[model samples]
Target: MRPTVLITGASTGLGLAIAKRLLETERYHLVLTARESSLERFAEAGLAPSEHVWLRPLDVTIPSEREEVIDEIEREGTGLDVLINNAGVSYRAVVEDVTEPHRLAQMDINFRSPMELARLALPGMRSRRRGRIINISSVGGMMAMPTMAVYSASKFALEGACEALWYEVRPWNIHVSLVEPGFINSDGFERVRWTELAHLALDRPSHPYHRHYHDMTDFIARVMHNARPTPESVARTVQRTIERRRPPLRVPGTPDAYLFDLMRRFLPRRLYHELLYRSLPHIRTWGPQAQPVMRMAPRAMR
Candidate 1:
């Protein structure tokens, strides 16, 4: 029997690309899921149905929907061999500007939902004594940045949990991997939510951090555009991780991701902080500017 793999948030970006890539392999039966609107968008993109690919509408944040989907999988006796938790959301704002609702929403989708899904899938995987779990994380998980506290916190929590789970499940031959990607050309940014206070603050010229916020946003856009790492690249990494007998615990999904991971691991805290601040246009200007000084010849020589 062909192995069965289920991917959440499979309507667009990395998740969608992963589903397509796995389908091409013809090694596993693919299950792709997204919200109803996302599913419609996927269909509109001309992804026709096939015997091997099953598309389902799923809102990962909803508990009932999650349980129903898992129940269906169990009833079908497909016995999931791989579970890819890729559904997530992000927002940019300082803690003072973030709303309670927005913070919780990020937590629900990025951290809680994925954990819950894993809880449901664990029993079957443990029974089978073999499986793969891949969590789509972010470089932010390793290195937190301004205006990304909530998003980074969610991912950090996920990374910690998955890392521990990795060791726990290894005896059963279950491999857990975290795929951390830097800025990729994806719909994730387009879908980013701005807290109400952040939105209002950004619009106000009197706001202390308004200009900094604008510059940061622009910088991120430029970086993502220039780097241009496609979702296919991430999917390829995920595919390989799933195929390997003893896959790496963490996989960097892009070149930038690899670099950042290295810096996080080996760079001195002070030096790393300096480099990171210098890279951000907004933060770089926060310090005193160096005045140019022309040196005259020594008085005796002159």
Candidate 2:
């Protein structure tokens, strides 16, 4: 029997790419879950689930929907061999610009849902003494950046939880891996979920930190205009992680992801911050008197 793999946010972006890659191999039975709108978009794009694939609309943030997915997985003959927590959103703005509800929503989709899914899936993994939990984190997970405060916080929380889970479940042969990718390109930058308040602030130049927000948005647009390391490549990393004898605790999905991780671990703090600030040149536009500084921001490290 083929291994059963469950992927959240499976309708688009990295999730869709991962699903297609696995479908090509025909090595695994896939459970692809995403929000209804995303699934509709998937269908509109001319793709549908095959015999080996089970597609469903699931908002992982909802406790009942998450439980339902686990229950279904438990009933399957193969049970669950892998769980990919790929559902996530990034809110663009300064810390203050994000409303409290939006702040919580970012955490809910990115950090809380993944953590809870792991908690639900672990019992089954432990009972069987085998399973793989792969989280689709980001380069921001390794280090924080300007205008990404809340998003970074969410990933940071996930990274810490998964790291601890790695040590605790090593004895059970339950492999946990964090797949960190850098800036991923999307259609109209759908992945960059700018908060409503932040959007409004863009037109109001009088708004405090307006320069910071616009500069950051322009920076993201510029970088994403030429974003590399396709989603399919990152998806392949997820598949490879599952097939490993002892899946690595952390898998940097792109070259920049690896660079960021290593630099943070080895580089001196002052030097690192200098590089960080230099790369995020818009961050220098903190004060009203500061002019927008736009050069080739750090391309590789994201």
Q: Per-candidate TM vs. native?
A: 0.92, 0.91
Off by over 4 Å in 2: 282-285, 291-302
lDDT of 1 at 203: 65
1-302 per-residue lDDT for model 1 (tens digits): 88989899988888889988988888888878898778886676566677777788789998888888888777885788899999988888877887788889999999999999999999999998999999999998888888788999999999999999999999999999999999897545656677777676566645665655566666776677777788998899999999998999999988889899889789998999989888777564432532222221111110
Angstrom error at residue 290, model 1? 17
- CA-lDDT, candidates in order: 0.82, 0.82
- What would the per-residue lDDT of candidate 2 be over residues 88-129, giving only the tens digit for each residue? 878777787778988899999999999999999999989999
Any residue pairs clashing in model 2, and if so which? none
**Backbone clash count, each prediction separately:** 0, 0
Candidate 2 has a TM-score of 0.91
